[model samples]
Target: MMLSCKEATRLMSMQMDRELSMGERLQLALHLTACAGCRNFRKQIGFLRTVTRKFGDQIDDS
Candidate 1:
């Protein structure tokens, strides 16, 4: 089922933590496939996660 923008945005938080159930994950995945806005949001979150890890590594290397 195609999700509305608001629903997709709400899923953004759960998606980031990989906390959604399999069905919910599938729904969000399908929604994201056709929704560039949500896809970009997901990408942004992924970037944030990467940046966080880099910062953590820098601290560890210090």
Candidate 2:
């Protein structure tokens, strides 16, 4: 079954912290292929990760 946008997004975030099972990975990949919004969300998450790593303390918490 194809994943809903919400489920795909949840999986994308979870992927940042841990590895997904093969099934989850497949689901996420399929969802991203079909959903442009989710693809953008995934790209944004990746960009945020890069920025955070580069500017850890520079980004104010508050």
Error of 2 at 8 (Å): 0.5
lDDT of 2 by residue, 1-62 (tens): 89999999999999999999999999899888899999999999999999988996687978
**Alpha carbon deviation, residue 46, candidate 1 (Å):** 0.6
The models' CA-based lDDT, in order, is: 0.82, 0.94
Off by over 4 Å in 1: 56-62
Q: In lDDT terms, how accurate is model 2?
A: 0.94
What is the per-residue lDDT of model 1 for residues 1-62, given as tens digits with 9 covering 90 to 100?
68887898888877776688888888888998889988888788788889998996678644
Q: TM-score for all predictions? A: 0.67, 0.84
Off by over 4 Å in 2: 57-62
Residue 22 displacement (Å), model 1: 2.2
